[model samples]
Target: MRNLRYVLLAGLLGTALSAQADPVSYKLDPGHTMVLFSWSHFGFSHPVADIGITDGTLVFDEKNPSKASVEVTMPLSNLDTHVPALDKHLKEPDFFNADKYPTITFKSTGVKPLGGKKYKVMGDLTVHGVTKPVVLDATLNNVGPHPMTGQQAIGFNATGMIKRSDFGLGAYVPKVSDEIQINITTEGSVPKAGQQ
Candidate 1:
């Protein structure tokens, strides 16, 4: 937890010092953002699902987009596939082991702009108590006025593929596809006071 606080503070500081005019901050909106992902079944079919972020933040560094950062913490136990029995098994030790590891998280270490609105985000992802480096291809959708308050909102699409075994999520190997593709459609909204 101390490490998390430190990284966040550092990110804020970088954003604060670099912006001669103003810094842009984005608070990931749980209602408007989601991480939808899927994995193949027996190497033939794909089973899709999604996880909601309980909290997250992002800073867009126009000059040094490489300095841009994103952080997210999600409740592992909340994972679902819209199927009751399957959901139960997913939470067991063979899968998420929700009882042992209550949370899954990601802390970005680097963000490199590919060109225009495309970027490559690299971070450490923790799942089932194992941490691994993951890279995602991200596309900035748009930035514009918020319909409700006119505050600026930023949207994005990011995708990555992970091998379940790499993260110790290798319970049902061939039964569950080894490679899982994660899709992130993130929309960042200005945070309200007392909301962070």
Candidate 2:
């Protein structure tokens, strides 16, 4: 009976220690993260643009992936479509209206692990003053020490689709393709003790 009590106590202690291993929080390294978007242009060809990430935080737990979460902010005014004229037009009231709504944001609602290093991330995406639920098929690229910063870092690539019309940008609609593809590649690192 005494031995059984000792075993139970040891098990409880181990469980407590493991639970204390919370997910590490990573501050986005914006310079290393890239946000790319592509859309059909009148069925002739797909035009792609690069957007800039302003800030974000990623909390990840490899052992208990359900605890993973992310919050990202992208500056709408930083869009680059290669063509200067078109880029300016895109920010007009008819399109993104960057002046009125300056930033796009995404906050994770849930994360479901799919096998090894793959996850289905569901989140709320706010763009152009509208909010909608979005899902991304995410893959964990790597998690280790970063060569430049030497901080523990994590890399991920995620892909998701959104409809322009859904967000009230229905000017071209089917003609220009209402659906847009978003690709995100990011590397986040644990900040230094006082840096955060």
Candidate 3:
């Protein structure tokens, strides 16, 4: 009877520990993480540009996702619109002015769980030397062991919107569309033991 009581106590303690698991840190996989944006082109079409992520980190706690935080940095030179001419034009003083403001970044301020795997992440986004508050509607796609690397991994897809004028990137305004739709797909992994 004493042994049974001891077993019950142990089980309860284990359950509590599991319920309060510490947050895990993950390094963003640059090859799999990318930011895509699209905007209207003179009411003719919407052109999309792909921006590769340079580096980022994510802190996530599966049991308490609301405590999660993220920080990402991307270089303007990594922007690609498929057309070399257009890409070059975007980096000039007329658009992003990549020479002066070399990088864009986002840092989370708060996280709000919206039930299930959805969340609203509020953060400050810096672009072209301007900073503005933005909110991303994010969804957790999956969290498990990575098949190829055999490391623990997590993925998310998120979307948000911003105005070029807000970031001092408005060159054409209504002509080329001031509003841009931003889409992000990112994969993060826990480094293997003894690896940083």
User: Which one wins on TM-score?
Assistant: 2
Q: Per-residue lDDT tens digits of candidate 2, residues 1-196?
A: 9999999999999999877776889999889888898989889999999886989999998889888999999998788899999899989999999999999999999999999989999999998899999999999999989988789999999999999889998997889989999999999899998897
lDDT of 3 by residue, 103-127 (tens): 9999999999999999999999999
lDDT of 1: 0.84
Cα-based lDDT for every prediction? 0.84, 0.92, 0.93
lDDT of 1 by residue, 66-123 (tens): 8889998888655768887888888888788889988889999999889999999999
Better of 1 and 3 by lDDT: 3
Range of the 10 consecutive residues with the lowest summed lDDT in candidate 1: 16-25
The predicted structure with the larger TM-score, 1 or 2, is: 2
Quick one: RMSD of model 1?
9.3
Query: Which segments of model 1 are wrong by more than 4 Å?
Result: 1-21
Instruction: Give the distance in Å from residue 184's predicted Cα in candidate 2 to where it truly belongs.
Output: 0.8
Those runs of model 2 whose alpha carbons end farther than 4 Å from true positions after fitting are 1-18
Which residue pairs show backbone clashes in model 3? none
The TM-scores, one per candidate, come to 0.85, 0.91, 0.90
Which model is ahead, 1 or 2, in terms of lDDT?
A: 2
lDDT of 2: 0.92
